[model samples]
Target: MAAPIFSLAFALLLRLTYATAQVDPALISRACEYAKGGPTCVAWLQDNEDDAELSGIDRSDPDSIAFFSLKKIEKEAVTVSEAVSAKLSAGTTEDLSPATQQGLAECKDHYVPAVDLIKEGVDSLAGKAYPDAMKFLRTSTLDLIACQKSLAKLRTDKKDTEADVHATDAINRRDLLASHVALAQSILEFAASGGGAAAASVAAPPS
Candidate 1:
């Protein structure tokens, strides 16, 4: 009798758990919208990763996966910085084309928060809280992925309306940046989920 009762309770709990679990696949959508399709962060990552794989540029050198990931995050960061610089250079913060303006804003608000989370995750990993660190990186990765998909949509929407080759190049660049950011974000998430280190090896102890 007791065994039957225990089984019933277990089944009931499982049902309740499943009923309350809500996964928001669209969470990234909100993040992407916030950044408005900016791609600076993404493009930087791909270029560097390509260099690493093709030319042996190993700034981070975290085992193959971790090393590649660090290189990628650095790339995204550089791209983000460059985008900010471009915006300043253009002097068109408010006057940007609608798509560009939207992407820039999203990056500052939504995508940036994701970047911050990943940074915290990286820091946490160094402090021995692997689980917590992975959480932050994973969250950031999801949001960045959403940001990428949105930027692609934004590019498709704007490509035809570009005024000339120069204008087209600018739009393409933004899309490229977004793509790279998305890829980097995904890579980070993959690392965090696996419980493997994404950081470079520690220094050797003195004898």
Candidate 2:
């Protein structure tokens, strides 16, 4: 249970500033492929596979494809976070948004510590002893959502202030870093639950 969280933490630590960072088209397609399963996850995989085929076709510029792919990944993360948080809070679809700041507000106790800790890393979080990190991780989906808004607003602001896309890409880079941190906490919370344990246990040598 704790191992996954720890693993994610380590991954994010290595990622440093690129937490929610967007990947190339090929990576996005690959992630979607892994998510697809039978009726539940598989349908997604097939769709993503199809999407991958069209990846480069949609772009005259390479950055367009990267931006589009990044959007897809961020959107998917938002969708999953919303679904899980809604399940936890018994809320509705109105709760989730990439451009809004609702997810964290609605579920802050459950996710902020993880968010902060991931941002800060394991040596900083201090393991299971730190309940706040767990709470933060639970709400990481929300942070990702808020990050989207920050980046969007920053873009608009940048247009009024300067010529560099630096303000925009810099914001995105920050969000990506936060996303990675949240992902670490999410992986931990998921692994700690009975469901995670069972799943992990199954992939190991028989007792």
Candidate 3:
């Protein structure tokens, strides 16, 4: 009976260890540490371990991980853009201030370019052109920052609680994109040099 109990405990421990070994929590956390989502971003990556975009990916390869991260951010940008566009298109705008409405409109205008830049980065990654990928990511980062600034200006002009809520959500979305781009840049650097030079290059991603 004692031998059987010990065996059972060992089996459970092995299973736990196997599960923990499957995903690198530290990698996810470090990758998303700069984003607004923070821990939530890490959780998102963990939850999406089985995503088709990441299928059969070698998690140990920095390039592969960066590609996967870029694809994820691209999807997120698409989703957010679509949602905001639909809201502005079909939803009533009479309740919003002119500043808020204008800001949202500007965001909609930039969404296409933003997604395009990310897609370009994805293509660059696929082609093994890490520097090109980083450039595209940087361009998208700037676009997101511009969108956030637009919303920030809008927020200052209006004190409506509802607009404030919308602004907060929009800012968070921008931050997530920015974080993912930065992570992708870092991953590329790590892949290129393995250590020292990678750290210096990624310490300041283009703008």
Candidate 4:
């Protein structure tokens, strides 16, 4: 009887483990293939597998993966926006030029709106309003690009090392967000087309 109880306990543990296991590699590959930057999408998903909100999701479903990606993007946008705001608030003490200060303020302006758009996009995604979600996401991307370009212009005109550093960082982060936006768009497109095995099969394998 004790042996049977032990076996049952082990079986339950195995079941729990399986329930919480990472998404299947094949599934991740298949879903990521839809993104413009497949490898980046894969890396993001892999790195965020343990995210509190993502961990509870059914990662096997392409739609769920897309939703998770959108939420992640929203979170990133919010974080970047807050960082910019913090920088602006603390800039009073920094030896920043007036032009640099204005540029950073503009970046904050762009980022604040971008965060709002991303949040709206996430909400639309949750509601299965794919078109609205994509529209909002695309607009958010534009805002991020504008912020990046603002920094670039400042860096170019001022030739300030600090501005250059900020521009470089913004470029890298914007590019990552763009990739995630593309990923979410592709998955949303698949879902809009009646996502299933059939819709998934239409995508060509990643090179």
Q: Provide TM-scores for the models.
A: 0.40, 0.30, 0.66, 0.71
Model 1, residue 78: C-alpha shift (Å): 4.4
Question: lDDT of each structure?
Answer: 0.43, 0.36, 0.61, 0.64
Highest lDDT against the true fold, candidate? 4
Per model, how many backbone clashes are there? 14, 22, 0, 0
lDDT, candidate 3, 66-183, per-residue tens: 6557767888888667655543543244356566677778887787898998877766666656677778877887778777766566443445455455556666777776676676
Model 3 Cα displacement at 35 (Å)? Answer: 12
Task: Give the C-alpha lDDT of model 1.
Answer: 0.43
**Candidate with more favorable, higher TM-score: 2 or 3:** 3
How does model 4 score by TM-score?
Answer: 0.71
lDDT of 4 by residue, 55-164 (tens): 54445666566666777787777666666555555555455567867887888789888888877766665666677777887778778877777565443344444535
lDDT of 1 at 92: 49
Instruction: Give stretches of model 2 more than 4 Å off.
Output: 1-131, 140-144, 155-163, 190-196, 199-207
Cα lDDT of model 2 by residue, 71-101, tens digit: 3343444443444343323222223233323
Better of 2 and 3 by lDDT: 3
